[model samples]
Target chain A: MTTHLKRWWPLALLLALAAAPYSALPLPGLLDGPLGSPGSLQLIALCLLYGGLATGYDLLLGRTGLLSFGHALYFATGLYATDLAMLEFGLGFVPAALLGTACSVLLALVLGAVSLRVTGIGFSMVTLAFAQAGAILVQRNPGGYTGGEEGRSAPAEHLPDALIGIQNTANLYWIALAYLVLVLAVVHWTVSSPTGRVWAGIRENERRVEVLGLRPYGFKLVAFTVSGALAGAGGVVYLLLTGGATPQAAGSDATLALLVMVVLGGSGTRWGPLLGGVLYTWAAHRLGDLANSGSVAELPSVLRVPLSQPLFLLGTLFVAVVHLLPGGLAALPARLRPGRAARAAAPVTAVPEGAA
Target chain B: MNTVVLLTCTGLGLGALYFLIASGLSLIFGLMDVLNFAHGALLSIGAYAAWWAATDGGLGFWPAVPFGVLVGTAASVLLELALIRPLYARPRDQILATVGVGLALPALITGVWGSDARPFPQPAALSGTVDLLGAAVPVNRFVLIAAALAVLLLLRLFLARTRYGLIVRAGVEDRAMVTALGIDVRRAFTLVFAIGGAAASLGGALAGLYFGSVNPSQGTGLLVFAFVVVVMGGMGSVTGAAVASVGVGLVQQFANYYTAAGLGDLSVVVLLAVLLLVKPRGLTGRLA
Candidate 1:
């Protein structure tokens, strides 16, 4: 039946993506090399890593309706902790990753408790302040631990031999793919359980849930903790993909980029954030390539300048999506179908209003 | 003792800049419930415009300030009308739109101007140092303080004496009630945005003088501090912003001087967190 096919399609897609490393198909415009090439695998792995991150972030934004502006803090915590553990404490890869994830979870619990005290925009600002503090700490590189402006790279000796060189990029790609699958499975399981139903209630109308003798705070905290944990794990993978922990991962801009990804994908919908993440990462990389390709150099300065910057184009595209496509790219298919337009056009996520 | 005086003066100067940015941010958030994330971008526009005017447009520093303010105000008004007005129904979208603008404008600035910091043209009169409490303080600090004081006074007078100011205050208190009273609150929103843009742009111009150079990321870097001031001062209270700005600035200056260079910034953020956790309603206890 079509229903069974629809339900099982994700598994099929997963299988196909898992086998992508062995493919030598040359996609001319989409990538610079064949599918199995180290360069292509690296880009794909990065995209997959972000896809996982965006999905984790949606645990707060889409499911629980918490607009956290400090998600990057946890991500950065995972990144820096893993790198530092390896570099300073002489921990191997697995142990360092576990420690990093633990740190992120602990930070989320502590900060989430403080931030959740104030509802709505206050919570957002509080999280932002905390993240800003973290960013400042990293940038100051107290006692030269964080490498000041330039981030510290992972110690190659500490990492596994398979994850060290360019030839092993496919292994990294597999790790990224595994991360995405894990997140997808966890998010799918959680969002369907009883706790997930409560999250839905919290997202829709917290007052109603409270009136029914339930505590919204506890539910929200769980969501925040789990989301933070997933982000931390993603950070570990990101370190493997990129080979370092950069301060950019801790900045507010990084959080904003995640927000953009979730919104662009269609918040609250399965697979939307993943698709958006992959698409955005690909576009940004391709655009950067195009900018440096000297093609735009021939144009007038006015056109050439805007074309050269990937962020400008992405930001503008994000705004347009926010305006015209309220439900994001996920809603596009439904919108195109006859008589389903109105239903699909409605915003997928119920954003809390006037709380600032 | 002289070190303390110099630090206090410099901190106050920094606080003045914070006030300029925070006051507008407060009013806009108070009135529209929109976070206006692009506020930093507005400051950058003003700074870049003034920088261009001083160097490429052949305008002196005195004339360039007003020119920058003008351009900033125009850009903000356009943003309000074109981008923000359409999404009045969707508050979150409004914030997202501003975020987009925030990202895009800075990237545009870097693309056109390059990422390097450009030296601000110092007016001969403002470049010299003046002895303050036996500490040689830069004259530009005094200029910034004077400008902030003037703006503070003008803003208070406008809020207390003008009819538009009355509408703004009322709208902040209860927007639906103001609409029920047969008033067009949207006009006040545009006006507030304009006012905020002008103040932020002015801050940007003075910030250039204070820092001795202007860069694309300067406005955004200061924006975090401005957010601290805004939250500490209460969301919509102009007077509260002025007081908090001075407090934060002084704390940052003294802490940075006595301790680590970045510790002051960290302390200010800590202060904001503590204040929010303690009071939640801010110092003024006035809700937007």
Candidate 2:
């Protein structure tokens, strides 16, 4: 009973924390300040959306040990499908989102079945190629549903009133928050289940798992489908927030951004991706804004130019995280606490010696 | 008949460029388990270097080619030594690190060179058209084809006859055995990476001449193409990379000729996906 309570308490606390801003209850000064701003609320919502995407990505990457370079194909599909359903078919958000996610799952199953034939880096390359192909097709807009390069916005009349109306900032935030919780709950349930153990085994050694009579390929495909569905769901939230979808959202850049979130937050941990997504999105947003018009502009042309490109800093951050902090930001608390760093280092130091 | 011949020639020229980039990619992966995502950046750097040498340094194309190769080689060696060496045992981290480098380098290129693409200036002598099978082709196109063939022959001869080539091949087959045999296999990998960088840069310089212009974003697209070629050829097979590159180049060229604006690129990617689905080991790769 105690163990079960301990396990459930953190989740309950997290849900309350997420809901706190929407509630009328007064909070601490620091929390109250940021929660009150419409812009801050919107930013937080965006971070949650990204966090949700990263959580899904970790299912394939961290659990199944698949590095899919084209996962954005699913994201694009979700957004595009949802947009088309709402605009062209006159469907509501819930039905449109469900339909879009279904399409993304179908696409993932097809892509996964074909790609999983090649292991490791080959899988990454195949997925990348497919994604690139998908991006181009969307850019071409043969059916005119995608709106080509300009990217069509949901007409004000077409959207569900709250999503894009004047009250949108708060409405979008709550909606994104709700989706985030749902996605996280699903991921947590899936990872803790018996199936997730098989995925973990496959990640460690496919041949060994195969020898044990488990089908690694089918398991990987299921993980891919689930991850794709989650990413597609994130896309639906993104549509709700921005009211539009661009081909760029499904490009390799977005894939890299999502990868950074997953890796930075702690790839295998349940809460790590969510933490990473929020931190990364917030940092990127703040940094981009800060660099554009602030003290950065005063620097010399040579100095400012490289700093001006937001991705340079992002890339540098990713490298630093990989090299210095193998476990990512989520591991920092354990490392930073007194006496814990030594304890962590002690076991790690013995590992290489044993291998050698 | 003219269209056919012209398209064929166009395809070969593009194929030659693809081979230059893909062969190095194949070789580097063969020797060192490193994917070198930054290789595309090396190509772009080479193109920009040659462009700089020709326009700013007032050097001729021939001199600029070597300069670009040198710069590219140095950069690649630096990357291998400083960044890649420590992460050799961890492929996933290596991929991530290299990807970070890949992203950073292009942004750096944009910062240094500005965001705009410029037309690559060709030498006055080679810019003119030459007659080929009742078709008018640029002299530079023939020049590119010859250079590609010459490089392929040299590579073949090196692999077939040289002691170092034998060592590289032996290492690829079994690194542990080669290490036990007292060869410093890591040093050989560094050499292979340098050579790969040189090849990519040379190709980049020539690609600029072929395509007539380049920009920072060019590396990203080229990286994808190189990956397709490497995969289609089977990883770690130089000869297979060469053959697959030609096929890819021709398909891309023909697709561009027949299709609307962006579909050519789309078709190339689709072709790679379909081919990969059909032949996972690539056309000539060994299944270990």
Checking candidate 1 for backbone clashes, the offending pairs are none
Evaluated with TM-score, which candidate comes out highest? 1
Off by over 4 Å in 2: A1-35, A341-356, B283-288
Residue B53 lDDT, candidate 2, scale 0-100 = 92
Expressed between 0 and 1, the share of native interface contacts present in candidate 2 is 0.64
What's the true lDDT of residue B39 in model 1? 94
Q: What is the C-alpha lDDT profile of model 2 across A1-356, one tens digit per residue?
A: 99999789867867765664565443342232356356667777888888888988988877777888898999999999988888899987779889988999999998888888887666787899989998888888877888899887865676667677645578788788888888888888888898988888887778888899988889889899999998888888888888788888978888988888887877877778888888888877876776677688999987787778777777878877877777677777776785877766452210011000
What are the candidates' individual DockQ scores?
0.72, 0.49
Q: What is the DockQ of candidate 1?
A: 0.72
Leading candidate by DockQ: 1
Q: Give TM-scores for every candidate, taking all chains together and pairing residue i with residue i.
A: 0.98, 0.92
> What is the TM-score of model 1 when looking only at chain B?
0.98
Cα shift from native, residue B242, model 2 (Å): 1.7
